[model samples]
Target: MIVRIMGEGQVELDDAHLAELNTLDDELLTAVESGDEEGFRRTLGALLDGVRRLGRPLPDATLEPSGLILPAADATLDEVRKMLHDDGLIPG
Candidate 1:
C-alpha cells in the first residue's frame, strides 16, 4: 500500500507491515478516545516513525494515488479526531 503523509511525499508499504501498523493505529485510537494528549503524541510519533522506518520512499517523480493518507507529523489530537470521523484515513 502507498501511504501519503501530508507535508511529506509518498511511501510504499507492504502487506508485511500492515499488522504492526494496525497495532499502532489501535493505540492511537485508544489515545484519542481517552483524550490522552501525551499518549496521543507518543503513539502518533511512533506510528509516523514506523512508517518512515519501514516504508520505501517513492521517488519525487512518482505520482500514483495513495492507498491511505495519514496526518502530518505536526497534526494535533483534535485535527486527527476530525479526520477519523469524517474520512477513511487509515485502511485496516
Candidate 2:
C-alpha cells in the first residue's frame, strides 16, 4: 500500500502492516472525537513512526496514488477532525 504522510512525502508500506496501522488510526479518531490533543499527538506520532519504521520511502519523483493520507505531527486537533471519515484516516 502506498501511504502518504502529509508534509513528509510518500512511502510504500506492506499490506501486512495495515492491521497495526488501523489500530493506531482508530485511536487517533477516538482522540480527536474526545478532544484529547495529547493523545492525538501521541497516536499520530506512533502512526507516522510505524509507517517510517515498517515501510520503504518512495522516490521523491514518484507520483503514484496514495492509498492513505495521514495528517502531519504538527496538525491541530480540529484540523485532523475534519479529515476523518466513517472509517477514520486509514480505511480498513
Candidate 3:
C-alpha cells in the first residue's frame, strides 16, 4: 500500500516489505528494551539503508484550505452533525 500524507510526504510499501520492516522495528525495539546495543545497531543500520534506497524526500509544501468555510462556534453540535451527515461528508 502507498500512503500519501498530504503536504508531508508518502510511503510506498508492499506487504512483504512492510512485514519485514515491522519485524525489524520490533526486533530493534526489543533490543533497545533489553539493552542489547549490538543487535540494535545492526537492525538500525539495515533499516536506514532500506529507507535510503526506497524513500524519496518530498519537496516542502504547505496545505491551503479549499476555500470552504467551517460552521461558526455558536452552531449547535446536532445542527453541525446533520449538515455533515446530509452532505455525505461524515463516515457511515
Candidate 4:
C-alpha cells in the first residue's frame, strides 16, 4: 500500500502492516473524538512512525496515488479531525 504522510512524501508499506495501521488509526480516532490532545499526538506519532519504520520510503519524485493519507506530524487536532472519514484515516 502506498501511504502518504502529508508534507513528508510517501512510503510503500506492505499489506502485512495494514492490520497494525488500522489499530493505530482506531486509537487516533478515539483520541480525536474524545478531544484528548495528548493521546491524539501520541497515537498520530505512533502511526506515522510505524509507517516510516515498516515501509520503504518512496522517492520524492514517485507520485503514486496514496491508499492512505495521514496528517502531518505538526498538524493540529482540528486539522486532523477534518481528514478523518467514517473508517478513520486508514481503511481496513
Query: Which candidate has the top score in lDDT?
Result: 4
The C-alpha lDDT values of all candidates are 0.86, 0.92, 0.43, 0.94
lDDT of residue 34 for candidate 3: 64
Candidate 1 local lDDT, 6-83, one digit each (tens) = 899899998799888888888898888889999999998998899999999999899788888889989999999887
> TM-scores for all candidates?
0.90, 0.95, 0.44, 0.96
Those runs of model 2 whose alpha carbons end farther than 4 Å from true positions after fitting are none
Tens digit of per-residue lDDT, candidate 2, span 1-92:
89888998999999999998899999999999999989999998999999999999999999789998888889899999999998899888
Q: Give the least accurate 10-residue stretch of model 2, judged by summed lDDT.
A: 66-75
Best by TM-score: 4
- Residue 5's lDDT within candidate 1 is 89
What's the distance in Å from true for residue 59, model 1?
Answer: 1.3
lDDT of 4 by residue, 1-92 (tens): 89899999999999998998899999999999999999999999999999999999999989999988889999999999999997799987
For model 1, the run of ten residues with the poorest summed lDDT: 83-92
Can you write out model 3's per-residue Cα lDDT over 1-92, one digit (the tens) per residue?
44333333444434445555555556655555565767756765564445334544433463333222223323333433444432222111
TM-score, model 3 to reference: 0.44
State, as a TM-score between 0 and 1, how close model 1 is to the true structure: 0.90
lDDT of 2 at 63: 79
lDDT of 1 at 53: 94
lDDT, residue 70, model 4: 89
